[model samples]
Every structure is written in C-alpha cells, then in structure tokens.
Target: MSRRTPYFFLLPAIVFLAWFMVVPALQIFYYSFLNYSVFSASTFVGMENYRRLFADVNFWWTLLNSFLFILVTPVLMFLSLVLALCVRNLQRGTKLFRTFYFLPVITPIVIAGIIWRWIFAEDTGIANYFLSLLSIPNVHWLTEYPTTIISIMLVTIWRGAGYYMMIFLAGLALIPKEVEEASLIDGATIFQQTFHILIPLLKPTLIFIFVISSTAAIKIFTEIYIMIPGAPMANKALVSFLYQQAFERFDLGYGSAVGVVLFLITLSFSYVNIKLIEQRG
Candidate 1:
C-alpha cells in the first residue's frame, strides 16, 4: 500500500537466494563437519575432515594452483583492456568483432574443454601437427605437471578475456567524451590519458571483473576433468581433485571441506578487493 513498493517486489528474489544459495552453503559447512559418504549415511565427525585437508599434499597443491590462477587476473585485465581500447578506437565492424570474440564466453564449458583436449593432443592434434611441420617435437601438453597447468591457463585466458573486454568496453564508453577531448586539448599522450584518467574512473568496473574472474578461476574443473583425467604426475587444480574425491571416490566429507576452504579463500580476496577499490575511489 505504501510508495516504497520496490522492497516488496524484491522479496521473492531475496527468498530464492536464501533458499538456494544460503541454505546449500550452510549445508556444505555442516556436511564438512560430518563423515559423509555417497555409499552410506553421514555421521558427526567434528573437524576431522578439515584436519585431513590440512595434512594432504594435494590440498596444498590445489591451494597453490588457486593462487596461480589469481595471478592470471592481471594478465587477463591487461588483455581485456587492450582489446577494449582497440575496439573503442575502431570505426567499423566493432559489433561483429565483439560477437566473435565473446562467443567462447557463452559456449558450454564441456564442449570447449573437449575441443581443446583434441587441439592439445601431443601427436595428432592440429596444434602439434602444424608445429611439427616446422620441426618442433610434439609436446605432451596435458600429461606433464607444469605444462598441463600452463595449457589450462592458456585456454582459460582465451575463453575468458573477451567477456571482460566487453565489460571494459562498456565502462570505457560511459566515460564523458568531453573529458577525453579535454585531455587531448591539453596534449596528454595516450599512455598519460589512460593511466591518469581512464583507469581511475574504471576502478569500480575493474573491481567487479577481478572478483568475478578470480572466483571463476579458482573453481576451474571442466577442462581438467575432460583433459587431464588422472594422468599420472600431472598436478590438477584443487577443484578437479575435489571432484575426484567427492564423486569419484565417494568421499563427500573431504570434498565438502575442500569446497569450504575454496569458498573462504575466494571470500577473503573479494573482501580485500572491495576495500582496495573503495580506498582508490
């Protein structure tokens, strides 16, 4: 009955969030404290799951992998920004180019992973086939430790950068044209205008992209699951390993614990990013 009716309109979404996101997350935490099994009923187990997690070498490897992915965000940010700038400066076909670039972001991850697996194959894959014509030996891309990680990282960058580029392009477009004109009138070099004007104004968009990309990077599973598949000596990311433990091994407790740890690490980074963005603003 009141003029503040939008609050009532939003109530259903709030309820849905609580029912789905909030409740499932709390259940994951509770299950992490239990001895859960796919083949049997769960029993209370205190922090044993978490203790086992801390002592596991694979867990540490995954943690390191997660951090390594965070490092990728800056590289992606630069690529996205560069592409956005290029598109912004273009006078023709910008829409067509944007659609082509962002197609991977919308493609199903399973399909993308499968396609990449073939391309990365050592001998017969198109990538190595062409390389061999130039006399480069076929590289075992997915069977090696660091190389496997590197291959996954490369694919991740290719698949993700365009979406962020679009986001950045939108942010860049919203900047007042007169501000840029003023900079040009004052004889600001392109580098000076970008570093001093564009970046500072895009801080909010940057923070949003960072949080989204960092979280998505940590949860990387589809590619590793499709490509690596327990290849001996290859260090898979933590999420893929957790999938093996939970669904493959039926060790639900440990898997849920790993998920909890991943969530906490992501949350910490998101919080720090928010604070840094606020300070800069």
Candidate 2:
C-alpha cells in the first residue's frame, strides 16, 4: 500500500490529462482519416484529407510562414537573456524592474493585441509617428505583407520576452556564486565569463526555453489574427489555416488533418531536441 501511494496522488492528474488531452488528440487523428463536417455525415476516407492538405497552395504558404515564425524563438532567447542579465546585475529596484518587465505577460492577450493593432495602424499609428521623426515615409505596416508579418512578430516578442526572462532569471539564480568567483579570480573578462561559464551553465534553461518558444511560434494564431485580421491567405499561420477550415468553413475533417500534421511536427521537433540534449550529455 505504501509503495502505491505516490502513484495514487499522481493518478488524478494523469486521468485528467488523459480525459482532456489524449482523448481529444485521438479523436482528431481519427477525424483526419474521415470526411467529417458539420453539414455532412462522417465517412471514412483514409488519407483523403491529407491529400487535400498537401494539394492546397494556401497550406504550403502557411507552413512556410510557420517556419518563418520559428526565427522569433532565437531572437526571443537573446532578448530574454539580456533582460535577465540586466535585472540580475542590478543592485536596486530588482523586484520593481522584474514586475514592470513581466507586466506584458500578465496582460490579457486580447487587450495587448488590440492595443498593438492601433500601434500598427497605417495612418494614425504611433509607429509611423516615430518613423516620421526620421523623415521616413508613412509605411502601411498592417497592409503590407513583409512589414505586416514583421509587425506581428514584434508584438509576439513584446509579449513573450518577459516570460522567458523570468525563466532565465530563475536559472541564473540557481548557479552557485562560487563558479563566478572562481572565474573572476582566474581573470576572465565579463564577455568571456558570460559566453564560456554562465551561458554554458544555463544550457538546460536555454534548451527548455527554446523548445517552449519554438512550439509557441509554430502554434501562433491569436497574435497574428488580432494584429492582422485582414491578412491574406498566403500569409496566414498554419494554425490559422486549421482554424478557418474547422470553425469558419465547418470542414472539421480537413482541419483535423492539419492538426495531425502539426501534432507530428511538434512531436518530432521535441524528440529531436531531447535527442540532441542527450547526445550532448
């Protein structure tokens, strides 16, 4: 009885996850092989949905856009690390600075997105107002694809950097002071210490953040949707494509196919991350 006690304590969470996550994921996999939709009766149509998925040009574009979004992760990693370092080295107002920096993360995404929408607005936006200070033309930020994507990407960074910074700060705090003292006593420069000793020690934290950020980037929908409501089909995120197909068009089967692909991609990427980490170990 004692040996089984820990498992009992964990059982509720396991059951909860199985009921909510595993079951729904399995249903999506099953639906992807069917011709299920709201308007029509479901029928088994093995691989037909996937065939349609591959054949769709919009899907390819969205996939490419998703990959492009992955670039946001490394940029996030850098920004977060810098913020963490700055906060760590501060002698005063540490808690205040941390709270201010993390303020965006706690803000509701809808409110943040809405506020950013105005910031990126073509004519009356603050962004253009600032650009005008430099004598640059009024760029149609939300209207143009190249700039529109970049603007949305910036919003993501704005909201996410603080969260990642918190993680990095926690990791930095766990490092022993002895390690830094030893390095300093060896006459290591600040840059050398950071690159060689500190960062290398924070490898696990960095890997964890990378995995999390990359997954979020691939699954990004709300930020893109809220920022660029009128974004063209070719620039939509993969999840946006799935959302439109499922909810808007009522093509649940095809959307499930997309979901299945996304699931596989995320799974494979996580596996690769783990394998790389293990190999390094």
Candidate 3:
C-alpha cells in the first residue's frame, strides 16, 4: 500500500481526533496553568496547580487508588482466563453461553450502577441480607472505608471480567488444533499445556487485555459515582475525586489541574507499557 493511502484512510479519524480529543486535551493543559473557576475569569497561575495537587491529601489518596487499580489487572486477567476456558469447553449451546458471558459487557453502565447500588445498599441490600443469613450482622458495604474500596473492586471485577473473557475466548479459539493435539500427544497435563503452550501463544491477547483493563481501572468513575455517593468510596478513584473537585466542589481550576496530572500519568503509563512490550517483542 502506498504511504498516502494509509493517511487517506486515517484522515477522517485524524480530523475527528484533532477536533475533539487533541484540542480539548491541549485546552485542559492550558487551563492547568491558569487559576480559572467554572464561572470566573481564569488568571495565568504558572505551575501552582501542580504544586497544590502534590500537597493535597485527597489527591494523594486518589493517586494511590489509580496505582491500586492498575495492580488489580492480574486478578482480572486470571478471572477472564478461567472464564474463557470454561466457556470454551462447553459442548452445548456455546452461543448462548457466549451471550450470557457478554451480557455484562454490553449492559448499560447506568444499569450496572443501579444493580450494584441495590446489591450493596447499606440497610436493605441483598449482600448484607445474605451476610445476615450466616448470622453476620449487616455491614455497610459501600460506607465502610476499607470495605468500601474492596466492594468497589469486587464490583469492578464482576462487571469487567466477562468482557475480557470474551476477548480471551476469541484468542483461545484462534489457536491451531494441531498445537493442542501435539501437546496432548506429548503427555502434557492440562495445566502444563495451558501454561507452557497456550499462554505463550496467547501473549498478544494478554497484552491487549492488560493494557486495556489497566487503563479502564485507572479511569474508573461511573461505578463509584453511582454506588457510593456522599461516602468514602467517592474518594476511591482519582477521576471520581477530580469530578468532585471540578463539579461538586466547584474548584474547576484545581480540578483541571488534577485532570492534567491524571492525563500525564495515564499517558506516561501507556507509553512505558508500549516501550516494555516492544522491548520484549
């Protein structure tokens, strides 16, 4: 293909990205250097925004949350792989199973938020109700600090793992039958075959899942927003905290600064991930 052909094909995306993404991102960067409120005039403030962000206790927690979210990827990956294997091995109604697995992925986030909110409701929720079944007292899943984060993580894993599983299912299905047969002929156990053969071959899929899930975790918002309003979980994610500062607290300037920092951190993360993957490849 000619060099111009690729650009021609990409021209529309490039135009849309420049207008919507690049321009707005650059504007955020510009605003990060200003003391601009949502309603008031923005004054040039140099790097004061960044400085304040470093000193803000809540911002530090939010940053820590971002790292924790990234760290959750391995668990997510393991869950997805197990799910993909189970679904792949099903003999009857494979399509039905696939659809069931993908249902959460395609479900509206609003609906997920509503469902999880009900499930973890402080007093009337099913989770606590079930805990009460085991003679355990009702614990406020969404209100308690440490438990709140864990609850959100649990929800995150439940809502997201299936989507990654579908991706993994596709990758698993792509493996040549002969490869598995050869491994079987060599008397490899299921674990050995999967670990020594399948996983190495599935590296590309794993990498895709890792990067995408890590980014998704880092940008988590709506789940926390809908489920843990006015509670500790509100501060569980940097993006959510950024939203609080920007919209709720009406510190648009500071919020913009937070956004800028999040953008930088996320970009740096993706860049490093790509570089490491390239080196390994």
- Among these predictions, the greatest TM-score belongs to 2
Query: Which 10-residue window of candidate 2 scores lowest in summed lDDT?
Result: 144-153
Instruction: State each candidate's clash count.
Output: 0, 0, 0
lDDT of 3 by residue, 1-281 (tens): 88789899999999999999999988988888888776888899898988988888888888887777777789989999998888777898878877776788888877888898899897899998999899999887888776777777887787788889989988998999999999999999989998999999898789888888888888988877788777663357899888888888787778888888888877977897788689776
Q: Model 3: which residue pairs collide?
A: none
- Write model 1 residue lDDT over 61-170, tens digit each, in one string: 87787677767788898999999988998999999999999899898888888899999988679989988989999888878777888888888888988999999998
Q: What's the TM for model 1?
A: 0.91
Which pairs of residues collide in model 1? none
Which ranges of candidate 1 are over 4 A from the true structure? 1-15, 232-234
**Model 3 residue 48 lDDT?**
90
- What are the C-alpha RMSDs, in order, of all predicted structures? 2.4, 1.8, 2.7
What is each predicted model's overall lDDT from 0 to 1? 0.86, 0.91, 0.84
Candidates in order, TM-scores: namely 0.91, 0.94, 0.90
Native-to-model Cα distance after best TM-score fit, residue 176 in candidate 2, in Å: 1.4
How far residue 205's Cα lies from its native spot in candidate 3, in Å, is 1.6
Give the TM-score ranking, best first. Answer: 2, 1, 3
